[model samples]
Target: MLYQPDTYKIEQDLSRFGRTGNDTFIPGATEEGLRQYRRLLRNNINNTMVQAFPISRQVLPDDEWNELINLFFANHDAKTTQIWKLPAEFVTFVKEKDYATLWGKPWLNDLLYFEWIEIEVYTMPDIEAEPFTLQGDIRNGTIVVNLEYRLIPLRYPVHLYAVEEAKNHPGDYFMMVYRHPETREVLFADLSALDTFTFENIAHEQLSLSDIAAGLKLQFALSDQHPLLINMIAFVQEMMAQKLFLGYAVERKEQF
Candidate 1:
């Protein structure tokens, strides 16, 4: 009966505004009511913590729990029920600079952000075409590729760590994150090796597939039937089929 939706609303409201706002009518009654209300409100608040973040409860002492819960609920509003549906707030709390001192990890957010990106790339919609490699004159500046098939850009290195471990030491990295349309397998690669400039030139309708392939051959100094050329083509086909290649990006030329 106490946990009914309406009762829940009342309790939540008491937890939220019972201490802050003034009650005009029944001033003595309001003050007395607030005393009883805070007890129930604290219980309900702890229930939410039990449900949403059990780990915090297990690891934190009772005194610490109050601070942690209060910190999370400090800005909450009771009238709107939407806040209850929010994901566990511990992750955000632990990542904050102030909280990081408590958690003993400052880079936690960066690591989490990096891991989240991989989850994004793995779930990206299927790209129809497969990866295609070229061996034409790239060094001699003859290679061409679809601009759209250009290099993948990443602000953080998603490949260095698995989804879970990356949440500790996130760093900047750019590389391919590919997926095969049919098999749904993923791939990774370096942008420089794939020639990002050629990929972009092709993406923006700047070059034809044939011309691009020819350019690759020229740039890489390969003959029409070179073994290396054939291998390159096969590699592209595999990358495309499995969606192994992700995205391309240009490196900081000045870094060298």
Candidate 2:
């Protein structure tokens, strides 16, 4: 009887070969061929990471970045089959391993997240928008916003400042990332604490301008509402111009 290796063991060894450059388990595989295969796989992963995180690549020194990628390749068992999603795993790996603290870059996680959001927004599946009207009384109607959007709160102002500068100015930073409806381009806007709170309410709740103004007045102890409503209407108009605000949600009439 001929000797045959277990198929499952062979599969495991093949995976190990990619990570460790070891080819001893295969019957006829050459060390040189396995080395080439490993190099090719690693290079593909490196390229993907580079494309996804250009900012992180620029910030880290060549040696450190190379070492980090190598560590990730060897240590992490990626769950995603799509190569484009490997960077997302890399971000998780970095956070799990506390690479930022090890490398003395406190803003590293925020930087990685900021860069990743652009890719995420660009590649996210399309969302169907509800019926809306471009011309309506925004204050009276339920204001509609772009469905494909994300709000991220970071400890560092990485969106506004360079990594080095961001480290020094660590505080609460809110970023609004969205895709333009017509352009389909991922865009980012910085928000104040108040703006972030207000935008969150608008996105999650069916709040008209009057409702928002009333809530703000109650929350902030404001005596006047006219100026606040005026400013908010102007803000909504600006957002509509940017395609972030998709006018107001259309109210359907009841059937007889």
Using TM-score as the measure, the top candidate is 2
lDDT score, candidate 2, position 111: 88
TM-scores, one per candidate:
0.36, 0.92
Model 1: worst 10 consecutive residues (lDDT sum):
141-150
**How well is each residue in 75-165 modelled by candidate 1, as lDDT tens digits?**
5433435434332243445455356456653433334333333444556554444233443332222222222222445433434654345
Candidate 2 per-residue lDDT, tens place, 1-256, comes to 2446577667678778888664456767777877888899889989999999999999899999998898999899989988898888899899889998998999999988888889999889999788898888878788788988888999989888898999999899889899998899998888777667667777888688888889889988999877888877877788788877898888899999
lDDT of 1 at 203: 49
Worst-scoring 10-residue span by lDDT in model 2: 1-10
lDDT of all predictions: 0.47, 0.85
